[model samples]
Target: MAQLLRQLERICGDDHVVTHPHALRTYESDGLLQYHVTPRIAVLPGTADEVREVVVACHGAGVPWVARGAGSGLSGGALPVEEGVLIVLTRLHRLLEVDLANQRVVVEPGVTNVAVSHAVAPTHFFPPDPSSQIVCSIGGNVAENSGGAHCFKYGFTTNYVTGLEVVLPDGGVVELGGKAVDLPGYDLVGAFVGSEGTLGVATKIVLRVIPRPEAVRTLVAFFDHTSEAGQTVSDIVGAGLVPGALEMMGRLSIEAAEGAVHAGYPPDAGAALIVELDGSGAECDARFDEVVSLCEQGGATGVRIAADDAERELIWKARKAAFAAIGRISPPARGARADRRALA
Candidate 1:
């Protein structure tokens, strides 16, 4: 362990390698919180070349290393392997290119998911928006192949990634796919997208973008039972209507959201449904009516459609914060911080 730490310090500066117990605590677990392990060390590499050097060093020493993004992951993808180094990728973030004509953006793996959309939103948008887009990195999305409300219409991360530059397990760097669609070869990009870091580390990626919609409308419906809301979702899909976002929160989730953010959800409702339709104004209006009718058919007690952008954003914000809201519902255990210390 001492030799590996010395090698990492040599590869990256001593300042970039964290070995102290207090400093390494943050990398012990991801968002899941259930599984935890304090890595022997955490190394933050500032560039792809540095990442390659660190990986090579670890490979040479036969010490396993885990790749990590923003540490906001709900799954155990970023959990440290025993006695391994956690390669934190936050420092490698940089948007390299935005080809508007080709509708593709090339970015280093550590760039945040929302950063890409924010950069392009003025001109267009990247459509695979996970709820954690504001904080999660594109590289983590690639590893998890994450999906969210908007995916029903825009598709998942795999649909947007056209190419990847990777460091294989043996520390060899290679490029898979490219700007051109349907590159002549096996689907390495597809296989690597959702491999959950078991395959290799993504150093860079080419992402697809979509034109910003001219209009967006949000509608919320309250049903007596969750199954009724589910039926409505099925009916909407069965009618061949793809909503921009479709989200359902059960009674507990509704109470949590209302208590936390007050998104105007019906506190007494058994289930709440949030459905957004985005497109040209006329298309959205027509689809909105169809959605409302479907909800009514599925036993919706009441419905409220957002009349402005502010209201729409509030609805989405509540949905985005659902995970945190749910957490507050269950109070942390007594001496939780102390327990975490004991585990460490």
Candidate 2:
């Protein structure tokens, strides 16, 4: 172990290779706190070369290793193996390039998900917006194939990922896919994505972006029962109205969000459906009306439309805060259980 540490320190400065007990504790577990095991050592590599070097060192030493980004994964995908090394990628955070003409952006593994959308906002945007986008790293999203409320329309990480620079398990580096839509060979990119870090570590990613829609309309409909809201969702789809996003929250979730963000949800409503429609102004306007009518037909007691971008943001904020709100409202004894269920 000492010899391995020396080799790692030689590859990346000693300051980047963590070994002290206190520092190691921080990488012991990811967002899924229930399953945790302290790694033998944790190393922060700043470049793809450095990452490859560390992997080589671990490979030669016959030590297992795992790559971690932001430690925000809820599925224990980043959980460390007890006798293995944890390779932290936070130092590789840099938006390498933005090709607006091509509607694609290239970023390193450690860049946060929200940063990508913000970089191309108002004109174009990256579409896979996981609830943890503010802090979750893009590489982690690729590994988890994460989806957000808008996934019902835009699709998940696999859809937007056009290319990847990866460090294979045996310390080899490889590039799969590219800026083009289709590659002639095997679907290696698809297989690598959603592998939960078992395949390799993504060092650089090329993501496809899309032009912003001309119009966006957000609406929230209150229902007397959750089943009614579910029916409304099915009815909207059955009617062929493809909303940009459709989310449902039960009374307990509504109360938690209301307490945390004051999203103005009705306290007595049994369920609330936050739906959004986007496209050309004419299309959104027409489809939005149809959605509202369908909600009413499905037994919605009340419906509210977001008046502007600010209101739309607030509505989405409340929806995103639903899990945190559960923590705020649950008793201490049941908080862990509630969080587990929410993540599940």
For all the candidates, what are their Cα RMSDs to the real structure? 2.2, 4.0
Instruction: List the pairs of residues colliding in candidate 1.
Output: none
Report the error of model 2 at residue 255, Å. Answer: 1.8
Report the lDDT tens digits of candidate 2 across residue range 260-337.
Answer: 999888888899999999989999987888998999999999999999999999888888998778878766544456
Cα-based RMSD of candidate 1: 2.2
lDDT string for model 1 (1-344, tens) is: 78888888988899999989889988988888888899989999998988999999899888999999998888899999878989999998899998888798999989999999888877799888888888899999999998888898889999999899999888899998884546576899999998988888899999999888998889889999999999999999999998989999899888888889988888889998899988999999888899999999899999988878899888777788887799778867444867888999
Once fitted onto the true fold, the runs of candidate 2 whose alpha carbons sit more than 4 angstroms away are 179-181, 331-344
TM-score on alpha carbons, each prediction: 0.95, 0.94
Shift of residue 216 alpha carbon in model 1, Å: 1.7
Give the worst 10-residue stretch by lDDT in candidate 1. 177-186
Native-vs-model 2 lDDT?
A: 0.91
Cα error of candidate 1 at position 270, Å: 1.3
